[model samples]
Target: MHPIAKSVPLRLLVLLSMLLAGCLAESEPVEVAGKCGPRDLTPECCLKQNPGQWEQCTGSTEMVETAKTAHSVATRVVAAGVTATVALQPRINSAEHRGAELAVDLLLRVDKAIAQCVRRAEREVNDYHFDGRSPSRELCQQLKVGEQTTWAAYLGLFKHEQAWPCLRKALDELLPKKNYLLHPRFRHDGQTGKWEFLDEQAVKKIVSEQGWKGLTGSIEPDIVILDEKGFIVHVYDLKFPCPETNVATWTRYKNETWKDWSQGDLYKTALGVTPKLVSPREGVVPETK
Candidate 1:
């Protein structure tokens, strides 16, 4: 009928058109093969059906509603300037006030760090799914130095005994699988002045003392590995992101920041072992000599 159609074979033109249609279809968001109902609204089904709205489909309705309500309330509060404060406060302040302000800043940083790690993990899971592999707990074992350091910073902000479990999980996820036993919140007995491996009683006994609290509460190491005989073999300090500086500057910074009772020095001193500093970006484990 047409000049181009006449010039080309009809069968070949039809085949090319079909191939183009197939490519277009493949580029589009894949739709679920079957109908999705409430009872069978699994993540896989929801993702296939809605693409990006899987959360709305798969998340609990009650929990979603609750979250929406809380978000609305938070938005109003933020808008009303109820929690807003000027940053032009007096430079000179009481020691307690300064400490509290520093703690708040650290808490905010920790929250950001945790959020970044969670997002990265979610992306990794998505990639694994795209590669036709099911997400596994092994995904947790792929934490980089930055993630581990952020996790450690987050753990250091909390003083409660219950937070130790979280520390344990973080350590379990980040540490190398070297068959060594891990003690997340390892502490020494104040009475006998002896190191206790995986002992909560020892932690409780020393948590109350002012000196012990000062030593362990705000700056405890993330993990300590012990041999079969319950002796400390390696101490790890998960530090904040260090700036890219010359060797001398970096060395000075480390020396000043990781002085006595800071970093994992307290743990190392108590256990009579040198502590290793783990880089948050590269995951380098260099012993602090």
Candidate 2:
């Protein structure tokens, strides 16, 4: 290789190392809940559950992500404390403009603020990116990512109206892991109808009163599958925040909305349950304008 070419690869390696080992982070309150992604498997957790995930975790995206999740739970020494959620207020000229693209791509550093957020230890959310140029519903587009849809994020809380299905997926994904459930936090839309997770005070109440079963909400727990007799059996949906409400609040997104997190059960009925998950036939491409 030419001298310059040899140095080019070395320089690239050094820059990549910095991104993995030295990026600065700040905590915020908008963290979502139960954010177990493909990268959530910890070294021990990974090896214990399925070694393939850990051994194969070689890419930059996978390694950086796993270490981060493990750090959050590992950081909290005391069993109980004020719960925190990491939030990101992305400057979304249009949050739904992008089809299924992720939040990690931004040409500008300032835009980084809008990309990824390591929120409440319960859930990690990657904000959706639609358009930085404008916000118009004519630009109203479907924001999806496999099982998880990318609705325009409600700052500081889960997009409950759009978060239930994903939460169900989170529960299914993490169910086999014991520690993942021990000191769990519920992630859902908040009192303000935005992304948010369960507060510490509320979690203590669950343990003191309902125990893990209470982790399942008021809903009788039913799968959203459309197969004959339903695919899975029951699902006591998850709603973050507490259980109380103002009568008027019930009208905004219908009683089903997580507008008031204090309610006993937020999953009485699936809003968009049409037998099959109503997804587009084709993958979407978000417009940048």
Q: What are the models' TM-scores?
A: 0.31, 0.24
Q: Give the TM-score of candidate 2.
A: 0.24
lDDT of 2 at 69: 53
What C-alpha lDDT do the candidate models reach, one value each? 0.32, 0.25
Note the residue pairs that clash in candidate 1. 145-280, 146-280
Runs off by more than 4 Å, candidate 1: 1-183, 188-191, 201-219, 242-260
Writing each residue's lDDT as its tens digit, candidate 2 over 1-289 gives: 3322222222222222212221101111112223334564423223323423433433345444544453333222111222232231111112333122212432122112111111121132222322222223332233322212222212112222223334334534433211111122333333654323344556456556854334332222112211122122122222222111111111112123234432222322222111111111111111111
User: 113 in model 1: Cα distance from truth in Å?
Assistant: 19
lDDT of 1 by residue, 1-289 (tens): 3222222222222212222222111111111123334454444344334533424644645434543543233322112111112222112112232211114554344334433443333233233323433333334234322222122211112111122334445534543232223223433456875444423333334433532322232223444444333344545444332121212111111222233334344554555556555332334345655
What value does the lDDT take at residue 140 in candidate 1? 22
Candidate 2 differs from the real structure by a C-alpha RMSD in angstroms, to one decimal, of 20.4
